[model samples]
Target: MERSLSFRSVSILSPESANGRNVVALGVADAFARHGSTTIFRPSAASKDPFTRILLDAAESAIPLDDSIGVSPEVFRSHEMSMRADIVARYHHIIDARTLDSTVIVGTDKSPITDPEEFSLNAKIAADLQSPVFLAVCTLHRNPDELLATVHACEEAVDEAGSKVLGLFVTGCSPERREDTLNGLHELPYQVWTVPPQTVDPQSEDSIRQSLESFRQQVPADELIQASEEDWNIPVTPLQFQYSLLHQAKAHHKTIVLPEGEEDRIIQAADFLLARDIVDLIIVGERESILERGDALGLTQLHKASFQSPHDEELLAQMTTELCRLRSKKGMPEEQARKTLQDASYFGTMLVVLGKADGLVSGSINSTANTVRPALQAIKTKPGSSLVSGAFLMCFDTHVALFADCAINPNPNAQCLAEIAIQSAQTAQSFGIEPRIGMLSYSTLGSGKGPDVELVEEATKLLREQAPELQVVGPIQFDAAWSPQVAASKAQGDPVAGRVNVFVFPDLSAGNIAYKAVQRSSGALAVGPVLQGLNKPVNDLSRGAMVQDIINTVALTAAQAD
Candidate 1:
């Protein structure tokens, strides 16, 4: 597996806080650097905060600027003068006025500027430099009115000056207070970072350091840079099924469909996959028109993909025939069916159905309804499956687990739940994982009784009867499913308790939240909502999904088909 570190460079500007400046700043800088970032510290003298003073001292000690530059100043009049001079000089060198792009600026001072004119002047300079400023403010000590006014002043300046305010980082407040602060700042349109009370320790520099480090790691620097290079690229990795599909598509050298053919991101992804022999792409559009557009955009490599329109009679006819046969039992008129199946997407889906291609990749131009409706109606489900469910191969390097129904079937019944579990198990087995299914619920076994528990219990019993060969346990909470100690304490004799590879959730809401929680909390690489039980592999993509998303879906579909 290829591994690449995702990095984000950020500027830390903070005021004096309970934790001394040196400890907070140095600790945070150290943490961010450990996670792969070049941190630039900017100390503002407008507020004489101890945290800020300590940070300046720490930075000066850690990174000696005057010594490197050979600047000799006898006995500075004030700590502020020496610190300000060092920081300003360092800033000029690190973040030069010329050639600065895509840097995150973290501002610590929340003091409402008494001099609006001077504040506006500084704001203009900051904006002209093109930085995404993240304002860090304390909610505990500062008045809500003053905090809001200060953020508004900075943001207004940025907006007027044509700069970006990425978000507001609120620290030193209780959870309830944080929520109130966030609500108050609702008009700001910036992401709010409410530091947990536990994560914020006025006395302990380690706690604050850990908090800042956590924030820095979530910046998605690589994804942002990739997006800057290619307009539509989304940062994602291919898991087992998807990787298998990509390799197979490359082996066979067949054309895969890209409905959103014109997007620079999708085109870039297609070009990358093609250049690496990962897949042969067939972009859905007119050849000359797309090429002309690509040329105008200076994307010369986009010309490599094969192009086709939905109006192609042969393709439309083949799609119509396939859909009609699939829907033969529905008693639909041939003319209506033919007319309905003539869409570019339907034609592309039919290609997958007929084995003309290994897989179909789409969803850029169309909604999930438009992209997946035709496939559901035309391709139909596998022989025994009554409905479709999705599973995500949540991976942490070599360790991968399946999180099911995160995208499809909002609320499933007992039978649907059973099918999802069995299918997820099968999907896991296909990916070389021995299937140990855990039917997830808020309650473990029958300890906490409720309708939901009963539902999960019934589903587990149904799975046993439906697929006796499958090793499954039901009404297990997430902790018991993943932790051996918890499993031993709570679910003593359950075989699949701690070693579950496939996790079947009660519904979409549970599955979606659970998967994201685990992924963010544990740093798991989630790879699906892999639609299961289709006669062939057909899955839906999120509207905001990028080229890497399409590639991964294509690979998973192909792997299942194989």
Candidate 2:
């Protein structure tokens, strides 16, 4: 039981409707600081987005400058990624340099919710930083649905911009509407907390105290970060998992087969893996082409292992017969099976099937469907597995988050979703993660309804019935699933509410979009679509994957073989 996703900075965004914007912003930051996080206060005017400050900074006087100086919007945006990364990395450095528990809380001018586009300065900054926003809205004069609508707007905007809505903070409401607003906001999938309106000066001790007290009373403290350090803890960050997986793979001296052995990246990875002695490798390709290419590329070390060609007479005949027998119900003919076995995907997979190699790794030069098809037809599914799914190991500075079904299952039924959840949990554990699974949806604990919500709700029930010993909770929003404060507000007493390490997305659309958003926006390292439910380990690769990505995938494939 390890906690997940600790960050160096947290930014809070207030909706346009929030009263006393500065007061609300500072109030939220104060609470984080009190909870052992060193809060760095960055005002929205100071953001890297020039237009953001220009459009919204009322307090700062604009300097009159000559019109000659200009940077084109296209040019500015092209450099936006690097600039945003530098800003976030700078904050991480400052936070790490200090011994204290620290975080940087920057204030945005208004909710990007009402902003015309999702790529606005505030939104882009949040997306680039992968910061979780605490959307502040006033509930005093608004209808419950009105507040809920605004919150949803913010949610869409942040999500589109590549960030997450951590929770909602409501201020200046009578107790009656307050309850209604809180309940209504919960209908959507985010946490709802309250902040007392600062009628007096925001800088005053009383105002600060009241803000801190309100947040403390409304949101339960997250104790994970405050817990004492221990020696037996599993590695928590996904980037860290690369090293950990490589280390684990080397311990047993496993063998992994590479189907795309002739690809430059595969050659480089094979050379590297061999040089490091992380695992034994059986590279499947035309022996002459591999030798010629390896010699040309100075990757002669690949000759260390006998080149495994799919066309080898004995191996081809064995694979064809086995494949035909495996697919006998489909009445696959010997000629058709023999032709299929000629494919490197099939040949490489059969290496694992025949126990010649521990696992298979491909797709560096193939489509996911192409790489996975052979495994599904040959190695087949594991015992108790209904269908195969995918998970991306998102590595951040403080922790690693597992995002599931991101690459498969477009829209699964309850049983399929449940199976994916269980498979994802097992996958996480194989990588040394103690899986506290979160079944994510737009609704939390029956607060809302629809076919989608019901699917997740039903899937959660199925998972509980299937694996009662697992720490699984669902029909929970992303915010409530990961943030301690938000979990307290919306899903108190649920074990998996705030401590989830495995996030099971409802559909491929949500999972794919979310994992990509977090990766691009937050600059986190994502390690897989670590194909789950296969009886033997066979991983597909992204065509554009880097050399290190290939190495990591190979290591993971070997680890999965265990």
Maximum-TM-score candidate: 2
**lDDT score of residue 183 within candidate 1:** 73
TM-score of 2: 0.60
Q: What is the TM-score of each candidate against the true structure?
A: 0.54, 0.60
- Residues 305-362 of candidate 2 have per-residue lDDT tens digits of 6578777898788888888888999999999988887677888888888889999889
Give the runs in model 1 whose Cα sits over 4 Å from its true position. Answer: 1-255, 296-304, 328-331, 520-523
Q: In candidate 1, what are the lDDT values of residues 1-562, reduced to their tens digit?
A: 1212333333333332323222223444444444443334343333334443444343332333322221222111134323333433344445333332223333433344333343443333333233344445556676677778867766676555444455555656565686677777788754555554334453566765675565455334343233223221111222323444455555556556666666666676676676666666677767787777777766656666777776778877776676777888897666977777556677777777777665566666666677667778867788988887878888653356898988778999999999899889888887767889999998998789989899999999999999999888878998898888999998999888998878999999999998889888976656666778877666666666666666666656656665
Per candidate, the number of residue pairs that clash is 11, 2
Candidate 2 ranges beyond 4 A from true positions: 1-235
RMSD of 1: 16.4
RMSD of each: 16.4, 13.8
